[model samples]
Target: MESWELGEWYGEFLDALNRHDLEAVRSLIDPGVRRAHLPRGGEAWIADLGEFFHAFPDWRWKRIQLVIEDDRIAAHLRGSGTHSGHYRDIAPTRRHVNVAEFAIYRVTNGRIAEFSGSSDAELRAQLA
Candidate 1:
């Protein structure tokens, strides 16, 4: 796909995530997508993503920017959610936090095949 198309697709994926539309999210992600940030990767990451939304059912993702190239898309996103559920290894603190995250996704056949990203430490501090 073209770079613009890839960027649009990534935007839609982010929309699905922000909306907590699991079915839409499933449609965008390849069943075997590899997620390098997770321990077991692939399905594990998918599961973790679902859990994240479960914990932060009201999570909102605001797009800061998106850069698309050949078959990759990088998204700079800012998100805010209430700590209503456990996230990662962090227990629920019932606090609200705004987080800034950057994600690079490798797209194949219009599906996200791989993803790697990091969250901003400053954002984490704000939450704390």
Candidate 2:
């Protein structure tokens, strides 16, 4: 895909996520998607996203920048959310937190086939 298309695609993906539409998010992800810090494949990643949304129902991501190289796209993002639900072992603090996140994703056949990037540690720390 062209660079502009990749940006649009990622924008849509983030839109779906911010809307908490897991099914829409899943539709854009390859079933065999590979993830660096989580269990491999889309289902596992989708499940993780589900948990994240539950913890931060008002979560939103703001794109800071994107660098595209062929099928790989790296994104720098600012994510913010309200801690209104349990996250891992931490109880909800009702705190609103903002965190920086960077992620790299490989697109194949117009779908996200692989990805890896930021962890929840930063957000968790803020909540703590």
Candidate 3:
């Protein structure tokens, strides 16, 4: 896909996520999508994301920029939320956080086929 097309596609995917629409998210990702650091596929991703939203409730991601090349798109994003519930062993502190995140996604057949990125350490630090 052209860079602009990929950008629009990615924007729609992010819109689904920000809306917390798991069904839409599922439709946007391949069933066999590969996760670079996770053990399983798209289902695992959906579950993990659900847990994150449970913790933050109002978490939102804003796209800062995108770099597209061939079938891959690199995204620079800013995510922000209030800690209103449990996350792992951390209890809610009612603290709000905004952190930068970098992610790369590989698209295949117009859907996300692979993903690799993290904001774990930075997110943890801010929540602490």
Give TM per candidate. 0.86, 0.96, 0.95
Judge candidate 2 at residue 9 and give its lDDT.
95
Task: State how far residue 80 of model 1 sits from its true place (Å).
Answer: 0.7
lDDT of each: 0.80, 0.93, 0.91
Error of 1 at 73 (Å): 0.5
* Residue 101 shift from truth in candidate 3, angstroms: 0.2
User: Could you tell me how far off, in angstroms, the CA of residue 90 lies in candidate 3 after the best superposition?
Assistant: 1.2
Relative to the unseen true structure, what is the C-alpha lDDT of residue 1 in candidate 3, on a scale of 0 to 100? 86
**Candidate 3 per-residue C-alpha lDDT over 13-110 given as tens digits, one digit per residue, 9 for 90 to 100:** 99999999988999888888888868567888888888889999999999998999999999999999999999878999899999999999999988
Ranking 1 against 2 by TM-score, winner: 2
Candidate 1 matches the true fold with a TM-score of: 0.86
* Cα lDDT tens digits for candidate 2, 1-128: 99999989999999999899999999999999999967988899899899888989999999999999999999999999998998889899999999999999999988999999988789878987
Q: How accurate is candidate 3 locally (lDDT)?
A: 0.91
State the lDDT of candidate 1 residue by residue for 9-127, as single tens digits. 87898888888887788888778887764654446666777898877888899999999889988889888988787776677778888878888999898788888888446545754
* Residue-pair clashes per candidate: 0, 0, 0
By TM-score, the best candidate is: 2
Name model 1 segments beyond 4 Å from true. Answer: 39-42, 119-128
